[model samples]
Target chain A: MSLNVVSLVSVGRHPQSGRARRADQDGRAVELGLKLVAKALSVVHVGDPDDPVLRQYAGMGLPSMTILKQDKSIDAVPILSQFLQQEKIDIVLTGVRAESGESSGMVPYLLAHALGWPVVARVADIVSVKDGEAQVLLALPRGQRRAVSVKLPFIASVDHAAEIARQSAFALGLRASIESVESVGEVDRIRVDWQESVAKSRPKRLKTVKAKTAAERFKAATAKPEGGTGKVMKNETPKEKARAIFDLLLEEKVIR
Target chain B: MSNVSSLGISSLGIVRRDPRKEWIARNRLHPLYHEVINEGLGSVVGPSGLIRKNPHQIGFIGPNGIKRIDRLKGNGADTSNKRHGSAQEVVLPLHVVTTPDFYLVVVPDLVGGRLSSHDKDILGLAHALQGGMEGNGAVVAVCFGDVKETQFDLAGVDRLIHLTGTEFEGFTPEARVAALVQIDTQLAPQHWLFPDSIHGGTDLGSRLAASLGERPATQAWQVIPEKVVCRGAGGSLDIARQTPRIVMVLEECGNAIDETRHEVLPISVDALEIQSAHLIDHGQVAVDPNEIPLAEAEFIVSAGNGIHNWAQYHQTAQALGATEGASRVAVDDGFMPRFRQVGASGTWVTARVYLAVGISGAIQHMQGIGQCEKIIAINTDAGCDMVKRSHLSVIDDSDVILSELMQLAQEYGVNDKPSQENSPEESQNVA
Candidate 1:
């Protein structure tokens, strides 16, 4: 059997601001990492330092999952490369990029190039691993799929549509000891210099139109030749019975 | 033969190229890259001397965007001073990285309308990396240097790792993978980077990651020094090393550098050589039983749960072409493809004409029908997302709709005639 390492699963933890962190790690970014570990020989995990509630995820041992104490100084990319290489692991799974680090979705491309492996993007399935080759499924835009074949020792980015992402039984959410490793390679560092968003002297709220339910949408859908009853305007001429509405200001004297 | 197969690849054969393939070759191919691939093949070198990509080390994938097709396409025109207005013009945004020598670019030749986009991305990134790494350090890319897009202030970083082979064209994912792997082995750059899109670069990053053991993360929204967060499902998140491990960033995601003062740098080559060049292997797909040919599918019933009622389904199925299917409610209660579903997340369909009854419009479902060019939907609510987006929508009840429509099908032999010829633009609406 091929050397499978890592316990990849979609994981969830409520954002620090959201009152409560999420309980499930399914159907989310961490799930991509979880999926990468779906078939693991042994796995290690690292977590944010302040979050202790995240500990219960790695207890069950059938397919081991581990967690590391997250230090602000260490990034996940290099440590992960070290883990995979040291284990002689053959495949790695992850999302295109994390939901949080959305703007920097370049880790996989970098890691693949660094590890000297092929990185499959939007990969839906790892069909098989026989004779050093791995057949995979790729999901394209508009949900189209194409079956691609590549030799192993590659990384595949999981698609959000791959599956609902299997959930872990609550009863199995036991705590496990997560090993800690000092991270290496600090590329560039900057001093802590921060600024907060300045509040306006007179903060104004944005006016919003809400779509509470489907019925309120008749105008958007049915008013045009396009099938919906809602009116959909076409190209307009400047002077054909033009109408305008004006707002009157009360004498209090100001609108910016 | 499918015209797409002409290039031995599956992209649309619609060639949008300006017949400048030769011009592309001259500027694109760097002597460094050409020399490496050629020399590797020339000398029967083996894996002994190659710099195998080490997962234990760092796998830094750099950003390689498309070459700007039109020089002024994205210019903000910040160069001219504004004689009026309190605001000053901002310098045009450049996405070069802080370190150049610490990265290597991996590129496949061009294809599609993205050649220019890819070229710009690669060059922009190269400029960013080289700009940052100027005085010292070097980033190694995994290309057999038929072309390289590097921008350096000094000449030291101007190098290419070209692979020699026509099979390494842009769309040849398999061959590209093999060559990238070889390059990683020979060049030893930990972090691999490439641009998102704009060039013909797709799947090259992910595919390359799979070939190596390193865990690869895709889709990053931003990359700050020491912190690399990846976005996934439920505001899903994945971080690259916690703080330290060298994070190889693509140009757009990481810190920006100065590219305006970029100057061409010339570098001496080590004459790296490739011992072998061949195809990369992609394994196989497990065939699901339901995925077999449906030509023999007798009375095939495909229900878009979007179809709200049993009544309109029967009518629309008959009117356009197709056998009626139970609504999701009816099916779940024991009538539909309890084993089958349609649209993006469900069973992919290849029917005569999928009777889209009351189905809502979704990008996922649309994907399964890229091959199916025709769709007809019906529902009592004219505003159903599916119907409005379909080729035709009959506003009526299923029972009345189906019974009357089946009569039309039986009379006009609707199912016997193909609806494939419906205007494609109008037709795309249904799926």
Candidate 2:
């Protein structure tokens, strides 16, 4: 049986320039969805229907996009969960976290809880789907991966380690039709209490010396700082220099 | 008599002291005083039959080749001796909470069966929160799987709930969350803190928060009893909100507890009836070094324009068991793929050890490798920026170093064959 896949996209802010653009992981989610069921993949957005950034996502070869028209202050969970329940989607894909707003990364879990469906986090790839179960790979730190098999009708959050989204074509994006659905959204009351401000850079933790004795305090104050100048091997033999590099590699445990 | 023994005279046998040598040792102006005295100017028997100590000669040479004096005298001798591995155990005062009015729960990621630095930071934040409130508050750490963390006391865990079973092993988030849910009902903690990390911490925390119906604060850096400051909008804006019951904290949220030890009292949770999980874990997949992405790779060997033999560079990376990386010039020249490029414009690598061969480091390239712990440069020019940034630099021809390194690696691989065989077999078993 053909699987019904839906990818959720969001407006992303560029980390450096703070410009509104296509979100990174959300685009990857769409790419993964396209890879799964290319022809049947449906892209959905929950914000403004007139957003120009929505076209960038559509430019990923989507013929059209469905936008659930809602205001920015609305709680997306209730609205999204309601919309998803009606679609009867076999698989719902989303970014691990949104790049804008709260960026709390709780939408998938909250949606899963509301729908009573299992949600997989940080999925690197969906290896296969067979016998109503999909084998997925989860990304771990240090280039590690965990393989898992989850039943269909589940939610998955795409990781950055997944295949990158294809480039957007301006002409294709302009031709794609945008279907807007009007929906009344409940205003989020809790967010009103939050005070938003420009982020202040955190201070780098300094190495504080906890000396019990006067001599140690003196040593800590007067001792020359470490690791400024590196050892340069100029006239050493090739064997000696190679041995030095090898020893350093071994010390770092990178050559194991 | 003790002074005479310290002066190199045998205590068992009575020996006659030469008057000339004794006079030379006693006389500070005497040129032969240092040579005649076996012990340096520490302490000596004065002419008045009292022990005289030269306060200036109380210390030994420090590691930086400078003379340092210890003011604590003989009391500080063990501090220096501790470096020789016969450490005098310095026991910190224990912090015990007999009656906890409230509980601050911490669920650590504990990567590799040990409390990671991120875990410790959250634990510290839990303690800071505990300190801010009234009455006795205990920081309870809920850990899963095989816990190899022996220093939980040092990490400021007042109470430990270690759950170890086949169900809690591997990627069993469902079973782990079930256990946490049971703890929540039993303890009814005032606050729940988790490390906002990619290593299952955020996943489990969000899952628990969703099930508990608590709107958790994510990426929280500054947290207190009254308020929490968290980063939002991809770290561009900070949102200060009233502290929530569930908080996912960022690294360095608080300083790690170093001064005092905790009880680490073992706690138990009542039996949890875990529902049938929809996800089944098949364990980890073996990824080849070359297949791993440059950003997540722990060790990277990158090439640049100075590399004459492209084949030799690839072979060197293979031998070193490192992910292949290339400079912008190498990618621009079509020697490497675009994804293999390492720079500000390309993939920023967090490799523990970055080996740059023949790359004169550009400003953007240096910025990319800022987080790398150790950088080794093999360049012809000694004055290059890469060489300057490197912790260990070899000013030589790249061709010579690459060939030498390859041979050494081959020999090392042969010697390390026995240990390396286990990894392949383990991967095969997983498959």
Best by DockQ: 2
**Deviation of model 1 at A103, angstroms:** 5.6
lDDT, model 1, position A110: 65
Q: lDDT, candidate 2, residue B77? A: 29
Q: Which ten residues in a row have the lowest lDDT in candidate 2 chain B?
A: B1-10
The deviation in Å at residue B244 for candidate 2 is: 1.0
For candidate 1, what is the lDDT? 0.43
lDDT for each residue of candidate 1 in B99-203, tens digit (9 for 90 to 100): 444544535233322223334444444445444443533534334324534433321123445455556543356665666666666555635655454222446
Per-model TM values vs. the true structure: 0.41, 0.77
Q: fnat, candidate 2? A: 0.84
CAPRI verdict (incorrect, acceptable, medium, high) for model 1? incorrect
Taking the candidates in order, what DockQ does each have? Answer: 0.06, 0.54
Q: How close is candidate 1 to the true structure, as a TM-score?
A: 0.41
Kindly list the per-residue Cα lDDT of model 2 for residues B1-431, writing each as its tens digit: 11221223345533334556555545667786556443554687899999999876655544344665544322222334224222347788999999899999999999878998989988888898899999899999999988888999999999999888888888898888889889999999999999999888899999999999999999999999999999998899899999999999999878888989999999998887888888999989866676787898999999998899877887777778888888999888877877788999999999999999989999989888988999999999999999888999998999999999999999898233333222232223221
Question: Which 10-residue window of candidate 2 chain A scores lowest in summed lDDT?
Answer: A223-232
**How far off is residue B366 in model 2, in Å?**
7.0
Judged by lDDT, which candidate is best? 2
